[model samples]
Target: MRAYERLLKYVSYETTSDESSETCPSSPKELVLAEALVEELKQIGVADAHVDKDGYVYGSIPATKGAENEKAIGLIAHMDTAPAMSGANIKPRIIKDYDGADIVLNEKLGVVMDTVTFPHLTNYVGQDLIVTDGTTLLGADDKAGVAEIMTAAAQIIEADAQAGEGSAHGKICIAFTPDEEIGRGADRFDVEHFGADYAYTVDGGMLGEIEFENFNAASAKVHIKGENIHPGEAKNKMKNASLLAMEFNSMLPPAEIPAHTEGYEGFFHLCGMSGDEENAHLDYIVRDHSMDKFLERKAMLERITAYLNQKYGEGTVTLNMKDSYYNMREKLESDMYIVDRAVEAMRENDVEPIIQPIRGGTDGARLSFMGLPCPNLSTGGHNFHGKYEYVCIQSMDKMVDIIKTIVRKSN
Candidate 1:
């Protein structure tokens, strides 16, 4: 099947990940799509196609004739859609040869994607654009990547069959992981079993988005233990933890935040804050590109706990810090061909590569730390993880070309 058809069919599955769950996949619905994709991979002539217990589908296409000894190239995409929106029964619309105007997604709901709000729509004039009906997310965030990999795998096999001896290709491996939206996609991933020299997750945004660098991440959870006393005479005795949480937030750099910083700028974003007089909590994710800034972000949190302890006795503020992921650029820089191949493939296919540091983390960021040295490629998607998500069918077709080029150009 074509990439567009594959995307439409895959999005039909309600594979929304759940962040609250403790399971590997975090949701049961992802298995529905995982099984379906395993069948699809086997139907496409993939050998040993199967979904593992952790809900990852892994398969391989053996190298052909002269390319048998070539390095293995892996292409990966996520099975679960983002947990931020609904992925149930998505109604996608195809606007053929778009006229460069506002797109009305739902007539009765008055939901539309205005060109004024999304000026990027102007770039897709006269191309096939697939949009949602404004009720649910389009799930194109990674399904577009999935379809592109599947289609490219089929094309590689077809080309080998048609070209006879020397024109086949290297070993191609593909995997569809689950719960990537919740940051657990790589937790159960078996890198050694996948057996690729390096890999690429086609999970980034836009057509030419190539991400080699991302923030080294750490999550901070602050717990404030307070003494709730009578409000009548509670000047020095009534220590409100809620007020302390606010004070903790105030200690961070006011200018350094996600909304205020971009492009190598580090920031401490307060994702959550809650509690009352007795207890309070603060959740933050610290991000930075530099190791020094990354360490400083962690140290800043530690300093806050120390300051609060000195003021309100020894064990008042408790901090729990956990490392999320690190910058993949350090590992990716060692082998720059992974990025160079993507840029060359985009240039050859009439798409200019947009090389930028991802403001957030991706599955590739963790995969790189896991010894794969993976980089990220684009899925030709925009406004992802929400109701306004859309995918360009023409760009999805071009992504197929990019993957095919990567397959043929593998050294």
Candidate 2:
């Protein structure tokens, strides 16, 4: 079957991950898709295919006779969608030969994707685009990648079977991981058992993005306690924790936030906050491409917390900070050849390679630190994790060809 068909099938399983869950997969529904993938893998001639207890699916396409000595390479994509949006009951619509105009997702609700909001729509004017209704996300983030890899694997398996001995290039390993949206996708990954010299995550955007570096990330939480008193009798004795929370937020640099930063610049993003007069809470995510800057950003938060405590009687404010992942550039520097292979593969297929640093983290970033030099490849998706999410069918087909080219050229 074609990659687009497979993608539509995969997205129908409602695999949105949960961030608050403590389970390995983070969500029980992810296993439903994992088991389906195992069945598909076995049907495609990958005899050793199975889903681990943690909901990670692993499969291998063994090398043909004479190519057994070639190094094994892995292809990976996550199975879960981000928890930021609803992935359930997704109603996808196909636009054949897009007209480069505003797309009306929900006519009654007045949900429209205009040119002003998403300029990238103009780029795919004459292509087949798969989009979603305004109510639910399309789940194209990594489902497109999953479909591309599956289609490529089927082709490789068929070619090798037809040619018999001494025909295929090398062993190709494929893995479908869960909970990447919550940053636990690589926590239990078995790199040694995967047995690949290198790997590529088909988990990027656009048609030719090849990313090896990503942001160094950390999460921070702030809790504040205040002395609440009746407003009518309030004087200097009353301390409002909600007002203190706002003051703490004001202390951060106004320009150094996610909305104002781009490229290699760093930012402190306030993801959520809730509170009242008695107590308040703040949640933030700090990110930077440079380790020194990353550390400085975290320190700045701690410094702010210290000053607040000193002013509010030493126990009014508390801070909790923890590192999530680091930049993969330090680990990938020695393995430039892996990046070159992907670039060459893209160029060979008439696709221009756009090499850039990722503003966000991927499963490959954490896996790289764990003894695997993995880079990211594009899955032909755009505007991921929202209702505007979409993928180009032609671009997905090109990605399948690029994966095949990478495997053939690497061997």
Candidate 3:
């Protein structure tokens, strides 16, 4: 089956991961897709295909005859959708030969995807686009990745069966992970058991893209406590925590935000905020490509916390900060050939490689640090993690061919 067809089947399972949940998979619903994937892998000739206790799926295809001694290559993709939008009951429709005009996603909800806001729509004018119905995200962030890997695996198996020893290639390993959106996709991963000298995560945006560098990530949570007083009797008595929380946000660089930053630039994003008269909270994520700059960003947050606490009471402001993942370029620098192979594979398929740094982290980032030397490959998707998300059919098919070329033996 085509990769997009498999994606339609995969998105029907409703695999939105929960950030608040402490479970391994983060949500029990992810296991439903995991189990189904295991079954599909086994049907495709991966005899040992199985889902682990933590909802990670693993399968492998043995190298043909003389190619048994060749190094193994792994393909990885996440199974769960992001929590930023709802993934339940996704109704996707295909726009065949897009006209480069505004798309009315939902007439009743008055939701329209305009070309002015998303000018990238012009890029897929002659191709088919699979989009959502304005109520939920399209789940193409990584499901499109999963489908590409599966379709490639199926084609490899079929070719090997027909050509026998003539179709020589290295061992191919496959894994589908859970909770990638919440940053725990590689927490319980068994990298040693995966048995790949190197891997490529088919979990990126746009076609012909190969990403080896990603953000050095950290999350910060700030809490403020204030003494409430009657407004009529208050002179300097009322210290509103809500106002203090706003002050803390104001201390951050106004220009250094997701909206203003691009390429190698760093940013402090305020993901969530809640406040009242006596108590308030701010949640933020800090990201930078440079390790030194990443440390400085964290230190800036610490300094702001200290200043707020000294100005208010000693126990007024409390800060909780933790590092998420570092840039994978540090780990993949020595094994840059893996990245070159992907670039060559894309060119072989007549697609020009776009080697760019990911603005966000992928499971491959953490996996590379864990001794796997993995880079990320595109899934032909655009506008991920929202209702306006889409994937190009021709791009998905091209990615499938590119993956096959990456695994197959050269002439």
Please name the candidate that would achieve the greatest TM-score relative to the true structure. Answer: 1
Taking every candidate in turn, the Cα RMSD to the unseen true structure, in Å, is 1.6, 2.6, 2.6
TM-score, every prediction: 0.96, 0.90, 0.90
- The lDDT of model 3 is 0.93
Whole-model lDDT values for every prediction: 0.89, 0.91, 0.93
TM accuracy, model 1: 0.96
lDDT of 1 by residue, 164-246 (tens): 54346688889999999998999999999898887899998889988999989999999999999989989879989999888
lDDT of residue 232 for candidate 1: 95
User: By TM-score, highest first, what's the ranking?
Assistant: 1, 2, 3
TM-score of predicted model 3? 0.90
Clashing pairs in 2: none
**Candidate 3: where are CA atoms >4 Å away?**
164-166, 224-247, 273-280, 307-317
Worst 10 residues of 3 by lDDT: 160-169
Model 3 per-residue lDDT tens digits across residues 89-112: 999999999988899999999999
Number of clashing residue pairs in every model?
0, 0, 0
